[model samples]
Target: MERSHDGYDLFSPEFRADPNAHWAAMRQAGCPVAHSDKWGGSFMPVAYDDIRDIARDGARFSSRAIEVAGPLEAAGGLYLPPLTSDPPEHKPHRGVLMPYFLPARIAEFEPFVREKARKLAEELAERGGGDVVTDFAQHLTIAVLTKMLGVPPGEQFTDWMIRMIRVGPKDQAVRAEAIHEILGYLGGLLDEREVEPRDDLISYLAAADIEGEPLSRKHKIGAAFLVLIAGADTTWSAISASLWHLALHEEDRKRLVADPSLLDTTSEEFLRVYAPVSVARLATQDVELHGRSVAAGERVLLAFGAANRDPEVFEEPDKIMIDRKRNRHLTFGSGEHRCLGSNLARLELRITLEEWLRVMPDFRLVDPDGVTWSGGQTRGPERVDFEVVR
Candidate 1:
């Protein structure tokens, strides 16, 4: 099979393990727009400025069409809410969803989030060691999202979400089956909510009126799935990558421990260094960028991982500075399509790291070589084993 125009093979273990080298090579080659037949019509942007420009100007580079072109679109079909829509239409959907994730509402979730993190940490501490990615990061995200969605904390929701959002080759049939199961469950939950509307996000959406009419069943389900998947998988990836970095760089970990005030800045550095999701957007109109001409309707991948490491933007782009000031990384993306749950993600990450460092200050990766990397839209360590050293 021919590799993508940018010479990236998505399935290649090397690419999965480390994409920075390939990104650097492409940027050196003059920020060219490279095509990939594998992704149907997607192109990779190699320069930092080009990606930032494209992301900021949604008029020319729309997110609507791109949401349908890639694997995510194929998986769940064309019913994604805000993540797959553009401005005028995007506004109301975002409006309906935003309140549930508002800073104040998220504050309400902090105690619950912290307790869950502490509980997970306690379990890991009991084991004295565990695969942080699978045991801790994955389950912590699942618990948080399920609780937020008003689903009873249980293995069913967690297992289903983990499987449903797992990135692989696009399988329309399997995806459709999963979607049907999820919607069926959500429909029943909505019915129950209607009978007795609770304060949960689903109930809020159920009662939300758009243009004077309540959100339809489809909108409810779509919005719920969008929030659930985004909230669960992406946050887990970010948390996992942050832990992985700390495990590898003991000195940086020590620095963070010395000055816990560095948590927020350290989180940003982690997002820059380990951008979990390599999100893509479709160009709605033809535009020339960084000497490369991209055609209208072509897929433009905003390589956040690459952009974060661009030499023109950040000095020592490869190094993870715990107290990195002047850092304006686009890991949460930019413009109207920026992540609504970013505040929540940051909160969760802060709590997770703070609690972990406090509980197991000297923990270390048990078998670094045994760790594996996973890829798709998001990238991170698949299995990271660690031991508590207290």
Candidate 2:
């Protein structure tokens, strides 16, 4: 209703708690592009068309600096390959990592993913109740990512990863220290892979070539950093949010449980309604859109979650129609930076839901009001405590 400086403050507790409500207010006020002075000033585009155009125009909107709250360069100075790379450099670097995420490669990882998810589900059932965020979603995602990256397989390694991503955005000193510590750990892993190559991502990167030239040491570490930072938070948020949704809606839960085949569309619907990621881009040149002027170098925040809910694109934007026939949402984003791990992310979400429903069929939130959420960039319930219906 009321705005500070005639713009939204993304870091405020209210916005983080319920961003959708804020977006609705902005839409009703007919503001397609809202300006905010927070984080060195950022412009948010809520409509689907605006977001799509900005994403496609790589020339105008540079992906070099993606951080909105603060800046933490990957591997000290080197850009995180593909994720932060732009244009020609982006293509070659992204191409190198493409093989690992291809459908065939992802299918190879399915057995491992399913086994981990199934075990977590059974453990949750045995306990009768647990915090799904920490106990289930975080554990499963960390295990898979560590195995893929050829790092030590344990939750201990995840503390820094979580802190670096979740807390680092809002705090500068913490982010710097976390980045330094992560680089040290990854550097050691890379050194080990160099001497004794193994059949893992680290070893592959050690010998992998970008175009004709071999990747530099900095390049190797930056690529690994991307997997560590991007891969874990985004997927787990999706998984945790999906479970949170099912825990609240009994009818949707029962329908999905009755006919598991609906998982395909249901997963898409969940992603659309609860899109977890919001990326940043730097405007290379001054531009005018929706009667607002964006100066060069100003950050444009792409709220994919808001774009997905635009009334113009979907018939009923607010309501989650699980069986919606024609659904086209930008949960994984669009254009060049569209998530590289989409296939892996989809596989993990589907299997997590399948195993969860199979083992813990009837469950509900232990305390809906107590379900707290994490803010900034990626948003998801921090704790989703639930118990069996029986």
Candidate 3:
């Protein structure tokens, strides 16, 4: 509140390291409509109700700016399909994309998830020392997404994905370049899918229908683009953060390693604790929230993580309770815009923890102070060195 800046800097190192403290301070500051000029003058709603209110009212908040728009918006530029579209229009695109992510459909991929996690865990166990982020999280996520899309793996895809996700939030020029490259690559892949169709998301999108005709090229690209960008960073971050917690908390680790069945509840607890997503929106009309006025066309950063940590919502919200019951955290945003990848993400986290504990029953951080974490758009352990006893 004392800062010269218009609003809080979400990308600040201090905030990223201890966002809950900042959120608590913001709540204490008693101004829910905190303003910032970083994203062209945005407002961040700190309270859980305020965040969800902005998310749920599609009529009042537009999602056009949920993603980068400065450079990514141009003639035939990337349109983020269901997510970027609002209300009535949001329905059809979301409709076309939803079936693939349904719980039943995601269930079909569980075996694949377990196998990939198992193979990766075994490799990491053999090595007995590795960074969870690069060694395990990256491979499992990239492989899972690639398999789901029915596409071959390439260094460019994964490497640029990491760059685009991490850098895009900080450097617009680099972000634009990354977007251009990805769009071009996805365009080429669409060409390949044309002739050599396979039983995967790519092929399905190629032939997907809406309103009695095949999907438009833009729709195809957007849908595939959504899957890549959404699935890649988010899942990997959640998985890596969970591992980091386990490496530090032995009692919780021992409980889970002892009873793998606890993973069902444990996975939800991890999501509540290490939830890794922050969505943005533009106000469609002036609105009063938590006793503050947000003007029309204003940008709003919905800090779901903050809402998840609201003391009113969760007792000792800062503490990670592996067996915590009745946690209604909004790790996933509220309303129709809730993350479509939730089912897949949960499966990946559960399976990764299962396989890791099964293979390396005991492990600890090589250097507690040496663990590096990523911040900004998504948060997770960028690198975690574990000394494992296999």
Candidate 4:
């Protein structure tokens, strides 16, 4: 069932739960540029090629704080740093942060990630079931992010950081209060790290020189916030979705369990289907795309989630095939602004899946109706309870 243009509410809970149907309907209606004033005049792109093209050409569709327009713009520094920037300004910081999230760096931390996953799985197994989203996924992601930032896992500081980073699209007043509190807290941490630097991403950024000068307090705080949120939320969502998929498809789980070698491909396939970060971009100048014209400064949401499921791109796009050979999904994104921490995310997901399946091979969704999704710029289940067959 499709609703008329006047009836479509982008921020509606129904839209958030399953947007693909709406996207398809919109695409068919000949209105590729679905506008929403709530998001500061942003347009949602439903086509596959258009999103890829827009992502590839940063100059034409500059990201630079253009996407986070509306209410989020006021909270300037609170938004994801470097990610909101484009080209030359985006390059220096991205370059400095790149090495830390490289595959080799993530490889070094694989043991730690595996241990966390095993412990979480073991705890859930003992309980005979658990909410994968809250108990397992969220905990695992927060643990890894805190570890990367040199924060001790399972500590008060970690707890604070996790709470601080979980701010999503909800009550603006509450979100702002949380942001202010977190910024102040992060400021103190930066000051301490300044005197006694550690071998962590935060310390590295604190000491990093963009052009003969060390990064400023705002830069450090902003970068740290971005890392915490990006590293935690998206990864947690991906893992949760992947777990949900596996639970629903026991045949897929059996296939993966039978041949552990397919882990890499399976991981990619999950990401392809469950692209967590539904990033929005803007058209810097008027551009024609697939017979549609986008005006200058017009916002275009590259429905990475929709694009991944584009029938033109993926064969049987809706189906979750674990062994997709040529799966080039835009989960991490495309072109220059592609995720820097994708390797780390992949490492964590790979290890988490391998370990979880080994311990609890048969798990069933407890109450499908009870499952809730946290709607925001990025979308994923809020709570997914399940029962493990011990």
Which candidate tops lDDT? Answer: 2
Task: Supply candidate 2's per-residue lDDT for 105.
Answer: 95
If both were scored by lDDT, which would come out higher, candidate 2 or candidate 3? 2
Q: Candidate 1's residue-wise lDDT over 146-255, tens digit each? A: 77888876666555554554532344455556667878888898889988988687888788888898888888888888887787767888898899888888998898
As for TM-score, the candidate ahead, 2 or 4, is 2
lDDT score of residue 80 within candidate 1 = 66
For model 4, the local distance difference test gives: 0.76
Point out the higher-scoring one by TM-score: 3 or 4.
Answer: 3
Per-residue lDDT of model 4, residues 1-390, tens digit only: 122532354557787688777877776776655656664556667778878888878888867543333453543334455787777788886876778887778899988899999999999999999899878988889888888888765544334433443343434555566667767867887888889999987788788877798877777788887787677778988999899888888899988989999999999999988887776666779987555567876667777888888888889988888999989898888888888889989998999999999999889898877776755466678788899865
TM-score per candidate, chains pooled: 0.92, 0.96, 0.94, 0.91
Q: Which digits, one per residue and each the tens of the lDDT, describe model 3 over residues 1-390?
A: 333224566667776676777777776766566666664456677778878877888899887668422232331234888878888888888888888999999999999889989998888888887888888898899988998988766667667877777776677778779889888888888889888988888888888888988888988988899999988888889998898889999999999988887898899988987878887777789877655577887667787888888887789888888788888888888898888888889889988999889888899898988766666668777788888965
Q: Give the Cα error of residue 317 in candidate 2, in Å.
A: 0.9
Clashes of each: 0, 0, 1, 0
**Cα RMSD to the true fold for all candidates:** 2.8, 2.1, 2.3, 2.9
lDDT per residue (tens digit) for residues 1-390 in model 2: 223325677767788788898888878887777887765678888899999888878899988887765642332243789888889798998998899989999899999999999999999899998998899998988888898998767765568766776787777677778889888888999999999999999999999997679999888999998888787888899999999999999999999999998999999899899898888888889988777888887888898999988999998899998887777899888898888898989999999989999999899999998887777778888889999877
Prediction 2 TM-score vs. true: 0.96
Runs of candidate 4 exceeding 4 Å displacement: 1-7, 66-69, 72-80, 154-170, 286-296
Off by over 4 Å in 3: 1-6, 68-77
Off by over 4 Å in 2: 1-5, 71-78
Candidate lDDT values, in order: 0.77, 0.85, 0.80, 0.76
Which structure is stronger by lDDT: 1 or 2? 2
